[model samples]
Target: MSDVTANEVTIRQYRPEDVKYLMEYAEENEWDLSMYDHLAYTRIDPNYLIVAADKDDVPVGFCGVSQNAPDTIYFGNFIVRKDLRKRGIGRLLWKAMLEKAGDQNIVLDGGPEMADWYITHGFPYQAYKVQFYAVKVNDEMKQNIMFKYDTKTLMESMWPDLMKYDSQVYTNFDRTRLLRAWFTGDDVRVAVAMEAGKIVGYGSIHRKPNGEYGLRNIFGDNEDVIEALLHNMLSVLPEGTVVHFMMPEDKPLPKYIQHSMKVEETAVRMFNKVKIETNNEKIWFATAHTV
Candidate 1:
Protein backbone atom coordinates (compact mmCIF):
# COMPACT_ATOMS: atom_id res chain seq x y z
CA MET A 1 0.00 0.00 0.00
CA SER A 2 1.41 3.39 -0.98
CA ASP A 3 -0.36 5.12 1.94
CA VAL A 4 -0.65 8.18 -0.28
CA THR A 5 -2.46 10.93 1.59
CA ALA A 6 -5.24 13.05 0.03
CA ASN A 7 -3.13 16.19 0.12
CA GLU A 8 -0.52 14.53 -2.10
CA VAL A 9 -3.01 14.19 -4.97
CA THR A 10 -4.59 16.68 -7.37
CA ILE A 11 -8.12 16.04 -8.61
CA ARG A 12 -9.01 17.06 -12.15
CA GLN A 13 -10.95 16.09 -15.27
CA TYR A 14 -10.05 12.83 -16.99
CA ARG A 15 -7.47 13.07 -19.77
CA PRO A 16 -7.06 10.69 -22.67
CA GLU A 17 -3.62 9.69 -21.47
CA ASP A 18 -5.05 8.48 -18.16
CA VAL A 19 -6.99 5.63 -19.85
CA LYS A 20 -4.09 3.18 -19.63
CA TYR A 21 -3.95 3.62 -15.88
CA LEU A 22 -7.70 3.51 -15.41
CA MET A 23 -7.96 0.39 -17.54
CA GLU A 24 -5.30 -1.26 -15.43
CA TYR A 25 -7.04 -0.12 -12.28
CA ALA A 26 -10.33 -1.70 -13.37
CA GLU A 27 -8.63 -4.91 -14.52
CA GLU A 28 -6.66 -5.24 -11.30
CA ASN A 29 -9.86 -4.88 -9.28
CA GLU A 30 -11.77 -7.41 -11.41
CA TRP A 31 -14.50 -4.90 -12.11
CA ASP A 32 -17.11 -5.50 -14.82
CA LEU A 33 -15.98 -2.28 -16.52
CA SER A 34 -14.29 -2.20 -19.91
CA MET A 35 -12.10 0.32 -21.73
CA TYR A 36 -15.03 1.13 -24.01
CA ASP A 37 -16.96 2.37 -20.96
CA HIS A 38 -14.16 4.72 -19.93
CA LEU A 39 -13.77 6.17 -23.41
CA ALA A 40 -17.54 6.42 -23.95
CA TYR A 41 -18.13 8.17 -20.66
CA THR A 42 -15.49 10.75 -21.46
CA ARG A 43 -16.84 11.15 -24.96
CA ILE A 44 -20.37 11.66 -23.58
CA ASP A 45 -19.38 14.29 -21.05
CA PRO A 46 -15.76 15.34 -21.23
CA ASN A 47 -15.76 17.25 -17.95
CA TYR A 48 -17.79 14.86 -15.79
CA LEU A 49 -15.21 12.18 -15.06
CA ILE A 50 -12.57 13.36 -12.58
CA VAL A 51 -9.34 11.62 -11.64
CA ALA A 52 -6.93 11.81 -8.74
CA ALA A 53 -3.30 12.38 -9.71
CA ASP A 54 -0.23 11.72 -7.62
CA LYS A 55 2.72 14.06 -7.17
CA ASP A 56 4.04 12.71 -10.48
CA ASP A 57 0.70 13.59 -12.12
CA VAL A 58 -0.15 9.95 -12.77
CA PRO A 59 -3.82 9.08 -12.33
CA VAL A 60 -4.40 7.11 -9.13
CA GLY A 61 -8.19 6.98 -8.85
CA PHE A 62 -11.20 8.20 -10.77
CA CYS A 63 -15.03 8.60 -10.86
CA GLY A 64 -17.46 9.55 -13.60
CA VAL A 65 -20.97 10.98 -13.87
CA SER A 66 -22.56 9.92 -17.15
CA GLN A 67 -24.81 12.84 -17.99
CA ASN A 68 -27.94 10.90 -18.97
CA ALA A 69 -29.89 14.11 -19.34
CA PRO A 70 -30.20 17.50 -17.72
CA ASP A 71 -30.15 16.97 -13.93
CA THR A 72 -29.87 13.21 -14.45
CA ILE A 73 -26.57 11.35 -14.44
CA TYR A 74 -25.42 7.76 -14.17
CA PHE A 75 -22.67 7.50 -11.56
CA GLY A 76 -20.12 4.90 -12.58
CA ASN A 77 -16.44 4.01 -13.02
CA PHE A 78 -15.81 4.84 -9.38
CA ILE A 79 -12.61 3.23 -8.18
CA VAL A 80 -9.40 3.89 -6.26
CA ARG A 81 -6.03 2.19 -6.40
CA LYS A 82 -6.05 -0.78 -4.05
CA ASP A 83 -2.86 0.21 -2.25
CA LEU A 84 -4.09 3.81 -2.00
CA ARG A 85 -7.49 3.02 -0.58
CA LYS A 86 -8.50 5.22 2.38
CA ARG A 87 -6.08 8.06 3.29
CA GLY A 88 -8.78 10.50 2.08
CA ILE A 89 -8.12 9.90 -1.63
CA GLY A 90 -11.64 8.52 -2.21
CA ARG A 91 -13.05 11.44 -0.25
CA LEU A 92 -11.39 13.92 -2.55
CA LEU A 93 -12.67 12.04 -5.58
CA TRP A 94 -16.17 11.92 -4.11
CA LYS A 95 -16.05 15.61 -3.32
CA ALA A 96 -15.10 16.38 -6.87
CA MET A 97 -17.84 14.08 -8.18
CA LEU A 98 -20.41 15.79 -5.96
CA GLU A 99 -19.28 19.16 -7.19
CA LYS A 100 -19.75 18.05 -10.77
CA ALA A 101 -23.28 16.87 -9.91
CA GLY A 102 -24.75 19.76 -8.00
CA ASP A 103 -28.42 18.87 -7.29
CA GLN A 104 -28.62 16.41 -10.16
CA ASN A 105 -30.51 13.14 -9.82
CA ILE A 106 -27.68 10.66 -9.44
CA VAL A 107 -28.21 7.00 -10.37
CA LEU A 108 -25.81 4.06 -10.02
CA ASP A 109 -25.70 0.29 -9.87
CA GLY A 110 -23.67 -1.25 -7.06
CA GLY A 111 -23.47 -4.49 -5.15
CA PRO A 112 -25.41 -4.99 -1.92
CA GLU A 113 -22.17 -4.61 0.00
CA MET A 114 -22.14 -0.92 -0.92
CA ALA A 115 -25.82 -0.29 -0.21
CA ASP A 116 -25.26 1.08 3.26
CA TRP A 117 -22.53 3.38 2.06
CA TYR A 118 -24.80 4.72 -0.68
CA ILE A 119 -27.65 5.20 1.76
CA THR A 120 -25.30 7.08 4.04
CA HIS A 121 -24.55 9.37 1.13
CA GLY A 122 -28.27 10.26 0.77
CA PHE A 123 -29.76 7.51 -1.43
CA PRO A 124 -32.48 5.98 0.69
CA TYR A 125 -34.91 4.40 -1.70
CA GLN A 126 -34.10 0.91 -2.93
CA ALA A 127 -36.42 -0.14 -5.72
CA TYR A 128 -35.00 -3.48 -6.89
CA LYS A 129 -31.81 -5.18 -8.00
CA VAL A 130 -30.91 -4.86 -11.68
CA GLN A 131 -31.04 -8.17 -13.53
CA PHE A 132 -28.57 -8.87 -16.31
CA TYR A 133 -29.62 -11.34 -18.97
CA ALA A 134 -28.10 -12.62 -22.20
CA VAL A 135 -29.51 -14.29 -25.27
CA LYS A 136 -27.62 -15.82 -28.16
CA VAL A 137 -28.81 -14.68 -31.57
CA ASN A 138 -28.75 -16.74 -34.78
CA ASP A 139 -31.02 -17.50 -37.72
CA GLU A 140 -33.04 -19.91 -35.60
CA MET A 141 -33.14 -17.59 -32.64
CA LYS A 142 -34.47 -14.87 -34.91
CA GLN A 143 -37.57 -16.92 -35.71
CA ASN A 144 -38.53 -17.38 -32.05
CA ILE A 145 -39.82 -13.82 -31.85
CA MET A 146 -42.04 -12.29 -34.50
CA PHE A 147 -41.55 -8.67 -35.51
CA LYS A 148 -45.02 -7.15 -35.16
CA TYR A 149 -44.04 -3.53 -35.80
CA ASP A 150 -41.94 -1.67 -38.34
CA THR A 151 -38.57 -0.36 -37.22
CA LYS A 152 -36.31 2.15 -38.95
CA THR A 153 -32.58 2.50 -38.73
CA LEU A 154 -31.78 5.41 -36.47
CA MET A 155 -30.38 8.44 -38.36
CA GLU A 156 -29.46 12.03 -37.62
CA SER A 157 -32.67 13.42 -39.11
CA MET A 158 -35.03 11.50 -36.78
CA TRP A 159 -33.49 12.91 -33.61
CA PRO A 160 -36.27 15.44 -33.07
CA ASP A 161 -39.19 12.95 -32.76
CA LEU A 162 -36.91 10.46 -31.13
CA MET A 163 -36.32 12.99 -28.40
CA LYS A 164 -40.04 13.67 -28.07
CA TYR A 165 -40.98 9.97 -27.82
CA ASP A 166 -38.19 9.09 -25.41
CA SER A 167 -38.98 12.13 -23.28
CA GLN A 168 -42.46 10.74 -22.62
CA VAL A 169 -40.93 7.85 -20.72
CA TYR A 170 -37.83 9.46 -19.20
CA THR A 171 -39.86 12.50 -18.24
CA ASN A 172 -37.45 13.62 -15.57
CA PHE A 173 -34.59 14.32 -17.98
CA ASP A 174 -34.15 15.79 -21.45
CA ARG A 175 -32.08 12.91 -22.80
CA THR A 176 -31.43 14.19 -26.32
CA ARG A 177 -27.73 14.68 -25.68
CA LEU A 178 -27.48 11.36 -23.87
CA LEU A 179 -29.23 9.53 -26.70
CA ARG A 180 -27.09 11.23 -29.33
CA ALA A 181 -23.89 10.40 -27.50
CA TRP A 182 -24.81 6.81 -26.77
CA PHE A 183 -26.08 5.60 -30.17
CA THR A 184 -22.89 6.32 -32.05
CA GLY A 185 -19.62 4.70 -33.14
CA ASP A 186 -18.98 2.54 -36.19
CA ASP A 187 -19.80 -0.71 -34.43
CA VAL A 188 -22.93 0.66 -32.80
CA ARG A 189 -26.39 0.32 -34.42
CA VAL A 190 -29.79 1.49 -33.16
CA ALA A 191 -33.29 0.45 -34.32
CA VAL A 192 -36.37 2.55 -33.91
CA ALA A 193 -40.05 1.59 -34.32
CA MET A 194 -42.66 4.17 -35.20
CA GLU A 195 -46.47 4.19 -35.46
CA ALA A 196 -48.24 6.65 -37.71
CA GLY A 197 -44.89 8.41 -38.19
CA LYS A 198 -44.56 8.92 -34.44
CA ILE A 199 -41.79 7.34 -32.42
CA VAL A 200 -42.95 4.19 -30.62
CA GLY A 201 -39.76 2.61 -29.27
CA TYR A 202 -36.05 2.22 -29.91
CA GLY A 203 -33.15 -0.01 -28.97
CA SER A 204 -29.44 -0.25 -29.69
CA ILE A 205 -27.01 -3.02 -30.48
CA HIS A 206 -23.29 -2.42 -30.11
CA ARG A 207 -20.27 -4.64 -30.39
CA LYS A 208 -18.66 -5.42 -27.09
CA PRO A 209 -15.15 -6.68 -26.56
CA ASN A 210 -14.56 -10.43 -26.97
CA GLY A 211 -16.91 -10.64 -29.97
CA GLU A 212 -20.12 -10.23 -27.99
CA TYR A 213 -22.84 -7.64 -28.62
CA GLY A 214 -24.73 -5.53 -26.06
CA LEU A 215 -28.30 -4.25 -26.07
CA ARG A 216 -28.69 -0.66 -25.02
CA ASN A 217 -31.96 0.66 -23.54
CA ILE A 218 -34.83 -1.14 -25.32
CA PHE A 219 -37.97 0.95 -24.86
CA GLY A 220 -41.29 1.00 -26.67
CA ASP A 221 -44.99 1.91 -26.59
CA ASN A 222 -45.92 -1.72 -26.09
CA GLU A 223 -44.52 -5.22 -26.11
CA ASP A 224 -44.90 -5.46 -29.88
CA VAL A 225 -42.92 -2.31 -30.56
CA ILE A 226 -40.24 -3.28 -28.07
CA GLU A 227 -39.96 -6.74 -29.59
CA ALA A 228 -39.75 -5.24 -33.06
CA LEU A 229 -36.87 -3.01 -32.02
CA LEU A 230 -35.05 -5.98 -30.50
CA HIS A 231 -35.72 -8.15 -33.55
CA ASN A 232 -34.47 -5.48 -35.91
CA MET A 233 -31.32 -4.92 -33.89
CA LEU A 234 -30.58 -8.64 -33.75
CA SER A 235 -31.31 -9.13 -37.45
CA VAL A 236 -28.60 -6.66 -38.38
CA LEU A 237 -25.93 -8.34 -36.29
CA PRO A 238 -24.20 -11.49 -37.51
CA GLU A 239 -25.17 -14.92 -36.34
CA GLY A 240 -24.23 -16.23 -32.88
CA THR A 241 -23.81 -12.82 -31.27
CA VAL A 242 -24.43 -13.02 -27.52
CA VAL A 243 -26.54 -10.03 -26.60
CA HIS A 244 -26.59 -8.90 -22.94
CA PHE A 245 -28.77 -6.33 -21.24
CA MET A 246 -30.18 -5.34 -17.84
CA MET A 247 -33.53 -4.54 -16.30
CA PRO A 248 -35.25 -4.47 -12.94
CA GLU A 249 -35.59 -8.08 -11.88
CA ASP A 250 -39.31 -7.61 -11.47
CA LYS A 251 -39.82 -6.47 -15.05
CA PRO A 252 -41.23 -9.22 -17.22
CA LEU A 253 -39.48 -10.18 -20.41
CA PRO A 254 -41.48 -10.94 -23.52
CA LYS A 255 -42.56 -14.60 -23.44
CA TYR A 256 -40.59 -15.44 -26.54
CA ILE A 257 -37.46 -13.73 -25.22
CA GLN A 258 -37.85 -15.27 -21.77
CA HIS A 259 -37.73 -18.74 -23.27
CA SER A 260 -34.08 -18.40 -24.31
CA MET A 261 -32.70 -15.60 -22.13
CA LYS A 262 -30.49 -16.42 -19.18
CA VAL A 263 -29.60 -14.30 -16.19
CA GLU A 264 -25.90 -13.48 -16.22
CA GLU A 265 -25.53 -10.87 -13.45
CA THR A 266 -27.32 -8.68 -10.94
CA ALA A 267 -26.72 -5.46 -8.96
CA VAL A 268 -28.56 -2.88 -6.92
CA ARG A 269 -29.67 0.27 -8.74
CA MET A 270 -29.79 3.32 -6.46
CA PHE A 271 -30.63 6.97 -6.74
CA ASN A 272 -29.71 9.87 -4.49
CA LYS A 273 -32.92 11.73 -5.24
CA VAL A 274 -36.50 10.52 -5.33
CA LYS A 275 -36.97 7.49 -7.52
CA ILE A 276 -37.64 8.45 -11.11
CA GLU A 277 -41.01 7.44 -12.46
CA THR A 278 -40.59 4.82 -15.17
CA ASN A 279 -42.94 2.47 -16.97
CA ASN A 280 -41.21 -0.85 -16.65
CA GLU A 281 -43.67 -2.58 -18.97
CA LYS A 282 -42.58 -0.42 -21.88
CA ILE A 283 -38.89 -1.20 -21.30
CA TRP A 284 -38.15 -4.62 -22.75
CA PHE A 285 -34.48 -4.35 -21.81
CA ALA A 286 -32.26 -1.75 -20.21
CA THR A 287 -28.70 -0.70 -20.97
CA ALA A 288 -26.30 -3.30 -19.54
CA HIS A 289 -24.29 -0.87 -17.42
CA THR A 290 -26.86 -1.02 -14.63
CA VAL A 291 -24.91 -4.09 -13.59
Candidate 2:
Protein backbone atom coordinates (compact mmCIF):
# COMPACT_ATOMS: atom_id res chain seq x y z
CA MET A 1 0.00 0.00 0.00
CA SER A 2 1.13 3.52 -0.72
CA ASP A 3 2.02 5.56 2.35
CA VAL A 4 -0.31 8.47 1.64
CA THR A 5 -0.68 10.95 4.47
CA ALA A 6 -3.68 10.22 6.64
CA ASN A 7 -6.22 13.04 7.04
CA GLU A 8 -4.03 16.06 6.41
CA VAL A 9 -7.10 17.60 4.76
CA THR A 10 -10.30 18.70 6.47
CA ILE A 11 -13.68 18.07 4.90
CA ARG A 12 -16.78 19.86 6.07
CA GLN A 13 -20.12 21.42 5.14
CA TYR A 14 -20.00 24.56 2.99
CA ARG A 15 -20.61 27.93 4.63
CA PRO A 16 -22.36 30.94 3.12
CA GLU A 17 -19.02 32.74 2.88
CA ASP A 18 -17.73 30.01 0.57
CA VAL A 19 -20.07 31.05 -2.22
CA LYS A 20 -17.73 33.77 -3.40
CA TYR A 21 -14.84 31.36 -3.62
CA LEU A 22 -17.06 28.86 -5.39
CA MET A 23 -18.19 31.46 -7.87
CA GLU A 24 -14.63 32.58 -8.52
CA TYR A 25 -13.53 28.99 -9.02
CA ALA A 26 -16.39 28.38 -11.42
CA GLU A 27 -15.60 31.50 -13.40
CA GLU A 28 -11.98 30.45 -13.73
CA ASN A 29 -13.02 27.06 -15.03
CA GLU A 30 -15.72 28.36 -17.36
CA TRP A 31 -18.46 26.29 -15.66
CA ASP A 32 -22.11 27.32 -15.58
CA LEU A 33 -23.17 28.84 -12.24
CA SER A 34 -26.71 27.55 -12.69
CA MET A 35 -25.56 24.45 -10.90
CA TYR A 36 -24.69 26.48 -7.82
CA ASP A 37 -27.65 28.68 -6.90
CA HIS A 38 -27.27 30.53 -3.60
CA LEU A 39 -30.98 30.64 -2.75
CA ALA A 40 -31.60 26.99 -3.55
CA TYR A 41 -28.50 25.89 -1.69
CA THR A 42 -29.78 27.63 1.43
CA ARG A 43 -33.15 25.87 1.12
CA ILE A 44 -31.82 22.32 1.09
CA ASP A 45 -31.47 20.97 4.60
CA PRO A 46 -28.95 18.19 4.31
CA ASN A 47 -25.25 18.93 3.98
CA TYR A 48 -24.93 18.56 0.19
CA LEU A 49 -21.92 20.78 -0.37
CA ILE A 50 -18.52 19.36 0.64
CA VAL A 51 -15.27 21.22 0.67
CA ALA A 52 -11.76 19.91 1.16
CA ALA A 53 -9.31 22.24 2.78
CA ASP A 54 -5.67 21.92 3.70
CA LYS A 55 -4.13 22.35 7.12
CA ASP A 56 -3.91 26.11 6.59
CA ASP A 57 -7.70 26.41 6.20
CA VAL A 58 -7.58 27.04 2.45
CA PRO A 59 -10.17 25.31 0.31
CA VAL A 60 -8.51 23.15 -2.28
CA GLY A 61 -11.51 21.41 -3.79
CA PHE A 62 -15.30 21.26 -3.60
CA CYS A 63 -18.18 18.94 -4.57
CA GLY A 64 -21.94 19.46 -4.64
CA VAL A 65 -24.43 16.59 -4.40
CA SER A 66 -28.23 16.83 -4.20
CA GLN A 67 -30.70 14.28 -2.88
CA ASN A 68 -33.25 14.15 -5.65
CA ALA A 69 -35.36 11.68 -3.73
CA PRO A 70 -35.17 9.21 -0.88
CA ASP A 71 -33.37 6.68 -3.03
CA THR A 72 -31.49 8.90 -5.45
CA ILE A 73 -28.70 11.45 -5.08
CA TYR A 74 -27.45 13.34 -8.10
CA PHE A 75 -23.89 14.69 -8.14
CA GLY A 76 -23.84 18.10 -9.81
CA ASN A 77 -20.45 19.80 -9.62
CA PHE A 78 -16.98 18.63 -8.59
CA ILE A 79 -13.87 20.72 -9.02
CA VAL A 80 -10.32 20.86 -7.71
CA ARG A 81 -8.47 24.14 -7.88
CA LYS A 82 -5.83 23.93 -10.59
CA ASP A 83 -2.87 24.49 -8.30
CA LEU A 84 -3.94 21.86 -5.79
CA ARG A 85 -4.50 18.90 -8.12
CA LYS A 86 -2.96 15.39 -7.93
CA ARG A 87 -2.67 15.57 -4.15
CA GLY A 88 -5.45 12.99 -3.64
CA ILE A 89 -7.74 15.81 -2.44
CA GLY A 90 -10.33 14.93 -5.06
CA ARG A 91 -10.31 11.26 -4.13
CA LEU A 92 -10.56 12.18 -0.49
CA LEU A 93 -13.58 14.40 -1.11
CA TRP A 94 -15.21 11.76 -3.32
CA LYS A 95 -14.87 9.02 -0.74
CA ALA A 96 -16.07 11.29 2.04
CA MET A 97 -19.16 12.36 0.06
CA LEU A 98 -19.93 8.79 -1.00
CA GLU A 99 -19.94 7.71 2.61
CA LYS A 100 -22.38 10.49 3.43
CA ALA A 101 -24.59 9.29 0.57
CA GLY A 102 -25.18 5.94 2.36
CA ASP A 103 -26.68 3.29 0.07
CA GLN A 104 -28.52 5.76 -2.13
CA ASN A 105 -28.08 5.71 -5.92
CA ILE A 106 -25.39 8.16 -7.02
CA VAL A 107 -25.16 9.67 -10.53
CA LEU A 108 -22.50 11.96 -11.99
CA ASP A 109 -21.22 13.04 -15.46
CA GLY A 110 -17.51 13.47 -16.13
CA GLY A 111 -15.66 14.53 -19.24
CA PRO A 112 -13.26 12.17 -21.05
CA GLU A 113 -10.36 12.69 -18.63
CA MET A 114 -12.40 12.69 -15.45
CA ALA A 115 -14.43 9.74 -16.79
CA ASP A 116 -11.29 7.65 -16.88
CA TRP A 117 -10.46 8.71 -13.33
CA TYR A 118 -13.96 7.85 -12.18
CA ILE A 119 -13.73 4.43 -13.79
CA THR A 120 -10.52 3.76 -11.96
CA HIS A 121 -12.31 4.70 -8.74
CA GLY A 122 -15.26 2.24 -9.32
CA PHE A 123 -17.67 4.41 -11.37
CA PRO A 124 -18.76 2.14 -14.21
CA TYR A 125 -19.09 3.34 -17.76
CA GLN A 126 -22.83 3.40 -18.45
CA ALA A 127 -23.46 5.48 -21.61
CA TYR A 128 -21.44 7.13 -24.35
CA LYS A 129 -23.27 9.66 -26.56
CA VAL A 130 -23.50 13.47 -26.68
CA GLN A 131 -23.21 16.06 -29.44
CA PHE A 132 -22.24 19.70 -28.86
CA TYR A 133 -23.94 22.16 -31.21
CA ALA A 134 -22.95 25.79 -31.64
CA VAL A 135 -24.48 28.68 -33.55
CA LYS A 136 -22.82 32.03 -34.32
CA VAL A 137 -25.34 34.76 -33.55
CA ASN A 138 -25.15 37.87 -35.73
CA ASP A 139 -26.98 41.21 -35.67
CA GLU A 140 -29.19 40.27 -38.61
CA MET A 141 -30.43 37.05 -36.96
CA LYS A 142 -30.96 38.88 -33.66
CA GLN A 143 -33.21 41.41 -35.37
CA ASN A 144 -35.25 38.65 -37.00
CA ILE A 145 -35.79 36.76 -33.75
CA MET A 146 -38.13 38.09 -31.07
CA PHE A 147 -38.45 37.35 -27.37
CA LYS A 148 -42.05 36.74 -26.27
CA TYR A 149 -41.77 34.74 -23.08
CA ASP A 150 -41.63 35.44 -19.34
CA THR A 151 -38.49 33.57 -18.28
CA LYS A 152 -38.71 33.48 -14.46
CA THR A 153 -42.30 32.45 -13.87
CA LEU A 154 -42.39 30.26 -16.94
CA MET A 155 -39.36 28.32 -15.69
CA GLU A 156 -40.71 28.01 -12.16
CA SER A 157 -44.04 26.66 -13.44
CA MET A 158 -42.48 24.30 -15.97
CA TRP A 159 -41.43 21.58 -13.48
CA PRO A 160 -44.66 19.59 -13.47
CA ASP A 161 -45.32 19.81 -17.20
CA LEU A 162 -41.67 19.14 -17.95
CA MET A 163 -41.71 16.13 -15.65
CA LYS A 164 -44.42 14.62 -17.84
CA TYR A 165 -42.23 14.82 -20.94
CA ASP A 166 -39.05 13.95 -19.04
CA SER A 167 -40.60 10.78 -17.67
CA GLN A 168 -41.15 9.63 -21.25
CA VAL A 169 -37.43 9.95 -21.89
CA TYR A 170 -35.79 8.51 -18.80
CA THR A 171 -36.59 5.49 -16.67
CA ASN A 172 -35.84 7.09 -13.32
CA PHE A 173 -37.13 10.48 -12.11
CA ASP A 174 -35.08 12.43 -9.52
CA ARG A 175 -34.17 15.81 -10.99
CA THR A 176 -36.45 18.26 -9.18
CA ARG A 177 -33.70 19.94 -7.14
CA LEU A 178 -31.40 20.01 -10.14
CA LEU A 179 -34.03 21.62 -12.35
CA ARG A 180 -34.85 24.10 -9.63
CA ALA A 181 -31.21 25.09 -9.39
CA TRP A 182 -30.86 25.46 -13.17
CA PHE A 183 -33.85 27.75 -13.51
CA THR A 184 -32.79 29.88 -10.55
CA GLY A 185 -29.29 30.72 -11.79
CA ASP A 186 -28.33 34.22 -12.98
CA ASP A 187 -26.85 32.88 -16.23
CA VAL A 188 -29.86 30.79 -17.22
CA ARG A 189 -32.77 31.96 -19.40
CA VAL A 190 -35.99 30.03 -19.89
CA ALA A 191 -38.54 30.31 -22.72
CA VAL A 192 -41.71 28.46 -23.60
CA ALA A 193 -43.45 27.59 -26.87
CA MET A 194 -47.14 28.23 -26.80
CA GLU A 195 -49.85 27.45 -29.33
CA ALA A 196 -53.62 27.89 -29.11
CA GLY A 197 -53.44 28.87 -25.44
CA LYS A 198 -51.48 25.75 -24.53
CA ILE A 199 -47.84 25.16 -23.64
CA VAL A 200 -46.14 23.02 -26.26
CA GLY A 201 -42.44 23.07 -25.30
CA TYR A 202 -39.63 24.95 -23.51
CA GLY A 203 -35.92 25.67 -23.84
CA SER A 204 -33.23 26.78 -21.35
CA ILE A 205 -30.40 29.05 -22.40
CA HIS A 206 -27.30 29.36 -20.14
CA ARG A 207 -24.95 32.25 -20.90
CA LYS A 208 -21.33 32.13 -19.82
CA PRO A 209 -19.23 35.11 -18.81
CA ASN A 210 -17.12 34.85 -21.96
CA GLY A 211 -20.12 35.41 -24.23
CA GLU A 212 -20.67 31.71 -24.97
CA TYR A 213 -24.13 30.22 -24.52
CA GLY A 214 -25.25 26.71 -23.74
CA LEU A 215 -28.66 25.34 -24.73
CA ARG A 216 -30.02 22.99 -22.09
CA ASN A 217 -33.08 20.91 -21.26
CA ILE A 218 -34.90 21.70 -24.51
CA PHE A 219 -38.19 19.78 -24.68
CA GLY A 220 -40.94 19.95 -27.28
CA ASP A 221 -42.97 17.70 -29.61
CA ASN A 222 -42.69 19.28 -33.02
CA GLU A 223 -39.82 20.68 -35.09
CA ASP A 224 -41.51 24.05 -35.49
CA VAL A 225 -41.88 24.45 -31.74
CA ILE A 226 -38.24 23.63 -31.19
CA GLU A 227 -37.18 26.10 -33.84
CA ALA A 228 -39.36 28.82 -32.44
CA LEU A 229 -38.06 28.26 -28.93
CA LEU A 230 -34.46 28.24 -30.15
CA HIS A 231 -34.95 31.43 -32.12
CA ASN A 232 -36.52 33.12 -29.15
CA MET A 233 -33.73 32.03 -26.82
CA LEU A 234 -31.03 33.22 -29.23
CA SER A 235 -32.66 36.60 -29.81
CA VAL A 236 -31.47 38.15 -26.55
CA LEU A 237 -27.81 37.20 -26.85
CA PRO A 238 -25.13 39.73 -27.81
CA GLU A 239 -23.79 39.79 -31.33
CA GLY A 240 -21.31 37.05 -32.37
CA THR A 241 -22.36 34.85 -29.47
CA VAL A 242 -21.95 31.10 -29.92
CA VAL A 243 -24.71 28.98 -28.50
CA HIS A 244 -23.95 25.33 -27.76
CA PHE A 245 -26.09 22.28 -27.11
CA MET A 246 -24.98 18.94 -25.72
CA MET A 247 -27.61 16.47 -26.83
CA PRO A 248 -27.98 12.71 -26.74
CA GLU A 249 -26.58 10.88 -29.73
CA ASP A 250 -29.78 8.95 -30.42
CA LYS A 251 -32.02 12.02 -30.39
CA PRO A 252 -33.39 13.20 -33.74
CA LEU A 253 -33.09 16.86 -32.74
CA PRO A 254 -29.33 16.73 -33.36
CA LYS A 255 -29.91 16.49 -37.09
CA TYR A 256 -32.24 19.45 -36.97
CA ILE A 257 -29.72 21.49 -34.98
CA GLN A 258 -26.90 20.49 -37.33
CA HIS A 259 -28.84 21.83 -40.30
CA SER A 260 -28.74 25.24 -38.63
CA MET A 261 -25.48 25.24 -36.64
CA LYS A 262 -22.04 23.69 -36.74
CA VAL A 263 -20.99 20.68 -34.67
CA GLU A 264 -18.21 21.79 -32.30
CA GLU A 265 -17.41 18.69 -30.27
CA THR A 266 -18.76 15.22 -29.60
CA ALA A 267 -18.54 13.47 -26.23
CA VAL A 268 -19.93 10.51 -24.32
CA ARG A 269 -22.12 10.71 -21.22
CA MET A 270 -20.70 8.24 -18.73
CA PHE A 271 -22.24 7.49 -15.35
CA ASN A 272 -21.44 5.41 -12.33
CA LYS A 273 -24.25 4.14 -10.12
CA VAL A 274 -23.39 2.76 -6.73
CA LYS A 275 -26.82 1.56 -5.64
CA ILE A 276 -29.66 2.74 -7.89
CA GLU A 277 -30.25 1.04 -11.22
CA THR A 278 -30.71 3.21 -14.32
CA ASN A 279 -33.42 2.76 -16.94
CA ASN A 280 -32.15 3.37 -20.50
CA GLU A 281 -35.48 3.20 -22.30
CA LYS A 282 -36.56 6.86 -22.21
CA ILE A 283 -35.24 9.79 -24.20
CA TRP A 284 -33.20 11.86 -21.73
CA PHE A 285 -33.82 15.57 -22.37
CA ALA A 286 -30.84 17.30 -20.77
CA THR A 287 -27.71 16.58 -18.78
CA ALA A 288 -27.70 17.88 -15.25
CA HIS A 289 -24.57 19.75 -16.25
CA THR A 290 -24.56 22.38 -19.04
CA VAL A 291 -21.06 21.53 -20.36
Output the number of the TM-score-best candidate: 1
Top of the candidates by lDDT = 1
What lDDT would each prediction earn against the true structure?
0.75, 0.62
Tens digit per residue, CA lDDT, model 1, 142-181: 6655455678898889989887877777776566666667
On the 0 to 100 scale, the lDDT of residue 193 in model 2 is 69
Instruction: Quote the RMSD, in angstroms, for model 2.
Output: 5.1
Q: Model 2 Cα displacement at 251 (Å)?
A: 5.2
Off by over 4 Å in 1: 1-8, 27-36, 66-70, 82-88, 142-146, 259-264, 288-291
Question: What CA root-mean-square deviation does each model show from the true structure?
Answer: 3.3, 5.1
Write down the lDDT that model 1 would get: 0.75
Estimate the overall C-alpha local distance difference test score of candidate 2: 0.62
TM-score of each: 0.82, 0.74
Candidate 2, superposed: residue stretches over 4 Å from native: 1-7, 34-46, 131-134, 143-160, 174-177, 185-187, 195-198, 210-213, 242-244, 250-268, 274-285
